[model samples]
Target: MMDVWKRLLARWAGGSLGGGWGVVLAAGVGVFVPGPEAAAQIVNVQALFDEATAPMGFSGTADLSLDWRTGSTNLIATRLLASAQLRTPPHTVLVVARGEYNFARDELLVSRFLEHVRYRYRLLPWLAVEAFAQHELDAFRRLRARALVGAGPRFTLFSQEEASLVFGVALMGEYEQLRRDGEVDAGQERLDPRLSSYMLGRVKLAQNMSLVETLYVQPRLTSVRDLRILNETLLVVTPNARFTFSMGFIAAYDAEPPATVSRLDTQLRTSLGVKF
Candidate 1:
């Protein structure tokens, strides 16, 4: 894993790449972490992987959200996200990190952090291979830690100037450890081999406007009923080459969640991004 990141950085430093996509700003979205009394926790990152303006060389974006209220019920919530990508021809590497905190009534309600790294190498015009690693911690779900690594081939099902579709599948090993809460074996540690599959689609509605949709499914190799699914849809509009506005919806479901947590969670977000 370290070797992969090392190679990507080496390649990025080897050449002088040009062009730029200005800084992107995502605003007006407050992250709400589910507490023990709330629904399940699912963090979908598909919308974070920007497909528009895939400038050659290097690009990055940062997002921040803050909400505060001082009334009968005090509340404060904040979220931060940072992402960087390096594209060198057939090789591309992307990294993302996000953190969230929510507090209400002088008590901490939720805290979460997530990190992901992905690398893709194109072998042909229609085929490519990808590998990714992810680590996460969520206090809302009583999850102390979760990690996974996977690699597999991706195919370009269809491609056009205005529309495209892609799909991929991989086998991944997942490890999870829950916080000790004495509720339904909350403090147990488990590992499972699972199949991860996804489909991504993009379509241009008009000049400077587009829609992107992504769906992910993961099921244990031995127990198909133990499944996880996530779906995200985003509508993006770019008035010019420097700014972007987007609204997205995410829905996630876990077949076997914590006894105290619900099976489904959903989120809606709207943000404007500026690029330099």
Candidate 2:
């Protein structure tokens, strides 16, 4: 029996059980056969392995909702959101897209869409390099279209099982087109340089619930008067491994908006999501 156990240990040390499973076996023994201090060390080792392996795969969420009302005033509203992440060890790619439409009295009240893609590569344990691109259109804001491309460095402030925070700064180039609204010119392209910074936070609120928040600020490199701020907050509840319910809020502000366009916009959303 002693020789058999030694052989098993030798195989485990020789990487015969695959990298993660050896750590799992060690953690199991630490938790079951040892004292509290050993358990803590096991947890730290597991976390290190998790960070190193990074769980290469694809994960995503999609949301769709519609509302219709008939009375003195008829209204219809539709919303759609989708986000996905593909992780390949030390590299990750992400995509997010959303659209909203509203109609009242058979006339369109609002129409807008936004899409973004980002890629990140881990350069060190707490540092990463990132690149991103985005496109947006809002008929209500008289924004015909906008495109942006950027690159930057991201730093992980903290990471643990219960909470995490990350911050990034980037230099971006933007191309914008506005509809002809008094002072604004139609079919005209405006290109500018901007500095952008963002902080993202995630926290576990309960056994089955989590909260995520992101704040972003962007200002023209030449003048701070031309600035934009965006905030997004979400609460998610999971009843099981495969399904989630979420409520989210988004607020955006522009210091210098196009003519006839509001400087501030806000939205509330609720969604049910499935995991695959």
Candidate 3:
């Protein structure tokens, strides 16, 4: 498929020297949108503890998503920390509308349109496949989409300690044709403000007992540019299925200045949640 695309581009445009085809292939695994499924309908909420210890600051996330899929289409509303979101996926066809609600100052942040659609097909008991494409959105206040595709598989591992471990690996590629409306000069083309490809994998040791490690790495035009290794553990207790408490810590490195937006320092966070 790669070769075919290359040849087609070469033949057209009078023997051009551009590998825009390669660029498209590079941005195929990082594009996706939220969906409303029966299994995911119930509000799922999570909270992370935040901390700071020299050269680092740690924090976790807290959010819940509501599912709406029936009749002629699908929709999802997710509320996290200081933000709320509304999404609409066109009746089985794949056009999505997204709006963000800001609570800190109480106002509408933005809204936009999205394209690209995909469905999943189970290949085996432990394997599944999903195909998607680059989604288009309207955002005059920020960077727009270029290209992205992310796909992978997940595995379930059980240990004698009654620990259920779930892990998955995915390859993501995205092209960021970022438009410089602010900050730097216009049409400056944020050099390498994109990651050609990225690797993502996570291991969940126990749901409420603790034990989780994740690896994330992506390049940018500014900020530190290197892979990051983070170690996190959570002590969680649930009074019931509807209410819970959690506290945790995180350590990160190889990701600071010139490659990211925040300082590369260890951090910590804590939070409480309730779902109905």
Q: Which lDDT values do the candidates have, in the order given?
A: 0.63, 0.59, 0.32
Better of 1 and 2 by lDDT: 1
Clashes of each: 7, 0, 32
lDDT of 2 by residue, 1-276 (tens): 434433443343234656224433333222111000000000001111123213468776676756442322235668777777788867776667778788866677666676666666789889987666555666655666665555777898988879988877777656566666566356555666677777777788999998888777777787888878777787878898677787777666777766555566565657677655
Candidate 2 lDDT for residue 208: 91
User: Can you tell me which runs of candidate 3 are displaced by over 4 Å?
Assistant: 1-122, 129-148, 159-161, 177-209, 217-231, 252-265
Deviating ranges (above 4 Å) for candidate 2: 1-55, 65-77, 108-110, 181-184
Point out the worst 10-residue segment of candidate 2 by lDDT. 34-43
Model 1 scores a TM of 0.77
* Superposed Cα deviation of residue 33, candidate 2 (Å): 55
Alpha-carbon shift of residue 253 in model 2 (angstroms)? 1.2
Global CA lDDT computed for model 3: 0.32
Comparing 2 and 3 on lDDT, the stronger one: 2
> lDDT score of model 1?
0.63
Top lDDT model: 1
TM-score for each model: 0.77, 0.72, 0.41
RMSD of each: 10.6, 18.6, 14.2
